[model samples]
Every structure is written in structure tokens, then in C-alpha cells.
Target: MSEQVIAAIDGSEFSEGVCDYAAWASLALNAPLCFVHVLDNHSAAPSEQDLSGNLHFGAREHLMEELSALDEQRAKVNREQGKLMLEAAQKRTKAKDISDSTTRQLNGTLVETLVALEKDIRLLVVGKRGETAHQASGHLGANLERVVREMHRPILMVPATFKRPEKVLIAFDGSKTARKGVEMLARSPLFAGSECHVLIVGAETAENHSQLDWALDNLREAGHQAEGAIRAGDVDEALQAYVQEHGIDLLVMGAYGHSRIRHLLVGSTTTAMLRGSHIPVLILR
Candidate 1:
């Protein structure tokens, strides 16, 4: 069976860009693609409710009219608009020869929809902005970081503006997470024949150097040609400079290192990298 890439999309332009990236990866890996749209129930609930259900007949009739008016005014886009957007998204996928695609409109929370579909999905692509974008108040969408922690699948968090990555940088620290990342590169056709740069930061001792060497051997053994180098500095700064200098297309790294709490408070180097890197990030946990 072909691998499956699940891209969560809304009708925005950013969602369309995410679909394009998902199509590229799906085609490269020979996988099927699915476009998903989740409607937040909180965003769709009726603005006003009638007390008519419990009121006297005369007052009930008056309140019923008010409720009906409120509901009519609250109606944003009808079901027909949703269908058209979904059809257009599916057509975009078909144009790229990814004809075997499905579009879904989900009700309830995005996290719930994602958690339910996590098992069969190989990659999850999401647009950074949503209808809630302007209201985000400088946060990275509420359920996003949570999904990254909970979902076992790899997540490609696409920025508002994106370009296909030509070369990728893998942040290797010789951890189990890093090893899994190497495995992803080997099995994924997206990184096949592309320049894979193995960056090892914070190697201060002999044991650290030995560990770095072992990690390099693993990548080479996996048939992904890679070059390794050790830099002396904070992980975030070193990675940023490396990407800027080399014109790196993507940055692959483990999600959390020591602990989630510590990472959240002080912020892990990986988290810091995400804030400043500006490139698409593939985060594995």
C-alpha cells in the first residue's frame, strides 16, 4: 500500500500552500494524499438561544423570532461554500497527478480529529495561520505544539510563505530521536539524493566526539550521504548560522530533549530554532 500524507487545510491561501507541499512530498514518496478541514464548533455555535422553550406562550413567540434572527445573522458561509472550497482543494491535488485524494470536513476540535487519524498518517502538514490567526496574540496556535508532543507521526509545520526545500539539515545529537530522524531520511524519498547535512553541536569531550562519529556512521550506512561538523556555541545560534550560510531548505530535529517542562520554561534549543529559523521545520518526537 502507498504511504499516506494527511494535510489539515482550511480555505485560506496558506492552506493551499500546505496542500502544494504535501503533494510534493506525497509524489516523491509515492503516497496518497488527503486534505482535511476541521470546523471549530465553538466558532459555529448559535450566537443567541431562545428562552422560549421554558417561557409562557406569548413571550415564547417573541423570543423565538429574536432567536431566529440571531441565527440568520450569525450564518457566515453556507454548506455550499464549504463544498466548493473542498472541491477546489481536491482539484489542486488532482492537477499534480495525485488523483487519489480525499477531502473531509470534520466537526469538533482539531486536536480530536488529528488524534483520531494519527495512526495511519505518515506526515501531518498544517498551515500556521487560520481564521484564528489575528486572534492568536503571538502564540503558535493553541493545539499545534500539543499535537507535536502527542502525535507520533512527523509533522511539517508550513509557514505562511513557503518554497520547496532543495537541501535539508538534520540536527543530530546521537539521541534515540535523532536516530529515528535518520531512519525517516532513509525511508523517505523526499530526502533521497538530496544533500543531507548532519550537524553535531556541543561536542565538548572525547565521549561526545565518539558519539558524534557513531551517529555519522549510521547515516552513511543508511545510504544517505552526509557531511558532519562540530560547532562550539549554543545549538540555536549555530543552527541558524549554518542554515543561512548554506541556504538550507529544511531543518529536521527531535522535538524535546531533556524534559518538556524545562524546554517550555527556558525553551529548548530546538524551540528557539523554530522561532527564528524562518524555514520549514520537520519535528520528530
Candidate 2:
């Protein structure tokens, strides 16, 4: 019953990177890895259309039966495709020296499946852009935003390519979720040897400084080489600028907070950061 890193694969160009990143996570965290490919039934369902305009009642019934058979056949084909995708992902993970891995093909939405498996999931690894998103071009994955919002576990979103991160940035805002994120970095092996930077956006208040100091102390005490700084201006812009300026390979942050509420009300800095970030994002709950 050990916690597992669940990597969602869609057989896209991003799938290989997802597997690679998940393998790194599994090694770092000493956790088992599971590859999950969801065969989205809703998306695969055949559209209903009326074709009785030129048919008798009996003929219409026959057509309906044929359509039903076609739908069944399509579902079967999709299931086989999903299985092949999972097998390929498993092979890739095993090649990364992660032999203690498993693969599953579920029949539902990806977010829903992850939520159902939340308790056993140590971390969820997914692609920044899924198969559909990649095809659409410039659009974020349909499930990325929703998964971050709905799941209560950590999610590691891998970009198109995988790079072993050497520097890590934690976006701290003094929120409970942010504090939890700090605790995770201190306790987990995920960022073990990476140079850690804690950045707080906005005017430097005593409270904010104190919080950053406390976080840095915690990380330093945990054997992490940690540093802290305060930046002024827009949160997302400041974050993006800092990453660009500092050569950050990974960005860690709480996925939602008052910022998420703002996203609901107006726009979300969290969403913007996710959309605009050039590196992989480790989103804590």
C-alpha cells in the first residue's frame, strides 16, 4: 500500500517526457510508479443523429442496431489503443530502471480517475499539453486547469522535453497551502540536491520577510541550500521574470489560494503562471 507516483499518458509526443519525469520522481521519492491511460468514454461516444427521413420504421430500427454495433466496435478499438499506449509507457518506465511499476487503463475522465485514486497517489505527473491540446496548438490541456483545481495531491506537470532540474524555485505567499509546500520540500526527496530559491512577490513587509526567513531556515535545516528574496510588481510577471533571470528549471507553488479565487472572479495569476511558465511546475495542493 505504498504511495505511488501516477503518470497520466495520452500517447502524445509529451508521453515520453511524462514517463521520463515520472521515473525521475519515482527514483527521487522512492515510490512506486503507475502509468494510467484513461479511455474517455464521453469523448469517444458517437454522436446521435436522426436518419429516419428516408427509412421505414423497421429500416430505422435496423440502422439504430447497426449504429449501436459500430459504437461498440469503436469502443473496443479505443480500449485496444489505450492498452498499447500503456504498454509503451511501461516499457519506457522500465527502461529508466523503474521495474516496480504498473499500468492501468481506466474508463472515465482523467481528473475523476486521479481523484478516486487520491489517497494512494503520492504525486501526479502529467503533460503540460495533452494529445488534444498539442493538436489544437497554443491551447493548454483541457484537464490541466481542472485537475489542478480538483485534486488535493501534488501534480508535476512536465513540459514537451525532460531536463533533470538543477535549480528549484518555490513561490511563497504565506498562505497555508504555500506553507504546506515548504514543508513538502523540506521533507520530500524530490528536490534533494537542487539549489532552492524562495521568492515572494510584492512589497517586503516584516511579516513576509519573516515568513521567507522561516521557510529558508526550515529548508536549510533540512540540508537544502536555500535562499530567499522579495520582488515587487505583478505576481505572475515577477515570477516569470525571476525564472528567466535565475535559470530556474523547476517552479514549485501552491496551485490555488486567494489567487485562485481571483481567478474565479477576474483572472488567475496561478493559471497565468502555469500557462506562461517555461519550465516544469510542481503544483502542491
Residue-level error in angstroms, candidate 1, position 49: 11
User: lDDT per prediction?
Assistant: 0.71, 0.82
The deviation in Å at residue 141 for candidate 2 is 2.5
lDDT of 1 by residue, 124-211 (tens): 8876555466354345655676676678778887776657787788877767666667777756788877777777777477866776
User: In candidate 1, where is summed lDDT lowest over 10 consecutive residues?
Assistant: 261-270
Compute the lDDT for candidate 1: 0.71
Indicate the worst ten consecutive residues by lDDT in candidate 2.
261-270
- Per-candidate RMSD, Å: 4.1, 2.4
Can you write out model 2's per-residue Cα lDDT over 42-124, one digit (the tens) per residue? 67566778877878769988988998888888889888988988888888787788887898888888878889999989999
User: Which ranges in model 2 have alpha carbons more than 4 Å from their true place?
Assistant: 256-270
What TM-score does prediction 2 earn?
0.91
TM per candidate:
0.81, 0.91
